[model samples]
Target: MIYIYLYRLPPNSLPRMNKVILVTGANSGIGLALCERLLCQDRQIQLCLACRNMQRAEAARSALLVSHSDAQISILRLDVGSTQSVLKAAREVKQRYNRLDYLYLNAGIMPNPQVDFKALFKGLFSRNVIHMFATAEGLLTQQDRVNPDGLQEVFATNLFGHFLLVRELEPLLCQPGHTAQLIWTSSSNARRSAFSLDDIQHHKGVEPYSSSKYASDLLSLALNRHYNSQGVFSSVICPGLVMTNLTYGILPSFFWTLIMPVMWLIRVFTNTFTLTPYNGAEALSWLFLQKPESLDPLAKYHSLTSGFGNNYTQPRKMDMDEDMSEALYKQLLELESNVRKKIEEEEQDTRAHGQYLNQTE
Candidate 1:
């Protein structure tokens, strides 16, 4: 359910400028890498690191201070899985920062990941797999969790929560005379097999993580179409294969070490397998330096590394169904409306209780 309020721009103000960039999931991994790179290059730029864990957020801020002591970094606790948390965090950010220049919606999760080495080994010799798994290009696995929203954990955490956050922060995003960019981190693993419009949440036994990523890809495209003219520019980026904490969770720590040689070998053939966090953040870092109007609204930008380990952007056409995306958007809007009404009802009940207490006193 994507709720968008359109704002008509005056003919005089066509170019909107932004000075602050907010990134979610900035406590570690590629998010942290983007924060460091952005802060190092621009002294005046305000970088807000939005994370779920306060301790990790503080540590990330401390680490950023090492390179740029005077970096304008703010930590906002945002658990995208929870609607209440997202709204509260948005309100707090709104109070603190009047206008947002860029929003890097990079916070995502692939929980309870399990690798099928057997499938990988089979794929090595077999030519049957038309769509390759992200890790080995044959098969992948995942562990399931029930989300706070009573949806599949991966779908809720990875897509729905972010969807809600964007809806909640719509006011701050469409600030006049400011071109706000919503950059989403998508993946090459977003295959057609992963997503089913019939069972979008992946509750009917499927690779929920990949399904969620595919949904996000569609959602971002839908957002761009609906809101590009309203001072909101949406873009999605596939950061390629990066060895990060999320990937580490899929396999044992020793597995990453043992497969280092194989990974390096693969890097020779396709340099997009960025072995380091520094390499992974290159595309996201590049976007921060780009003008909003200069960016393509419909194309998903891919972050790939060259043979020399240099970063570059490659435009890829996504297999997106416009009808499915619009359907998802409508469903989300209904969910949002119901959720908002529930919140309003709860608030009214609390207020009524308070008045009753005052009268009794």
Candidate 2:
């Protein structure tokens, strides 16, 4: 059985003109679903889809246009895994919009994921079955690689790139007298045990995806601490066990199809089995209409679906501390400085080489 959840804004709560919202990985899944929900609530808002592939981005735009024919939509080419691409996209955003109202950091990756079938089967008979299924704690692992930016691919794509994007667009996001929301598509798998302060990129860990997500949770708290006075608020959300392309990569489609009924049965025990993308995007769309000051910085909002097919958003306290979050923030700032210096040096070298070649010619 499929469940559909519909949301409508109060008549007085409709958005004003020139409210700009940008979403990374907006081409599909929860990100795309969030976009559609946002448009449904407020058609006057300017929505920008920042995706790595222009072709997929165009297709997504067309799909959205089919529903809201008069909605204003724009596309930006952004690969959050690549530093250059992120920097370039930030510049484009600055040129196009004077202020950004919401920045959805949703692009993420879990490369070469492998399911531990033995562990899964073992957990099925154990008392921790529901917890295991909800968080995928011991049942999944991934073979992570380093991106061209010399950072772990999972960390770069999931956490660091979004951090860099926030820093690049700080002027627009931190404007006085206006509040901007930084909503991250975090996960229930963001366990405190998975993350290490000594290795923020999870260089020596098998669960880079989990570590990166934990890092994001910490970073959101840190952002709230430092930027709340400047009107920038950061919040993270767990989309539950949504069967997106990322989830499909873990197990076969037929297997998930076969277990569809079982998943629904599991939902009675735990609301985390929000299997569809639209259901997973519940908390994301909910945050769009909230007052930032009323939200708890340390809480991780979750998308939940009841067995009776009711959808709602719940705020759960994350397993994190202010001190650790601040430390991670400082570390990220240092890393950002080093990355900028390295890029500047490389750019200088490239320019010098080009001039040398011109002289020789």
lDDT of each: 0.80, 0.93
Q: Flag regions of model 2 displaced more than 4 Å.
A: 1-15
lDDT (Cα, tens digit) per residue for candidate 1, span 1-361: 9999999989888874337888999999999998888887687788899999999999999999998998788899999887788889988988887788888989888887777888866764655432243433447767777866566778777888888888877887887776888888887777668788788888885588778888888888788778878889888888888888887887788877886786676677675677677788877888888887788766778778875788887777788778888887777777778877887898899999999999999
> Model 1 — which ten-residue stretch has the worst lDDT?
129-138
List candidate 1 stretches off by more than 4 Å: 1-18, 124-137, 346-361
Q: What TM-score would each prediction reach against the true structure?
A: 0.88, 0.94
- Cα displacement (angstroms), candidate 1, residue 287, comes to 1.3
The true-structure Cα RMSD of candidate 1 reads 7.6
* Alpha carbon deviation, residue 280, candidate 1 (Å): 1.1
Q: Candidate 2 at 301: error in angstroms?
A: 0.6
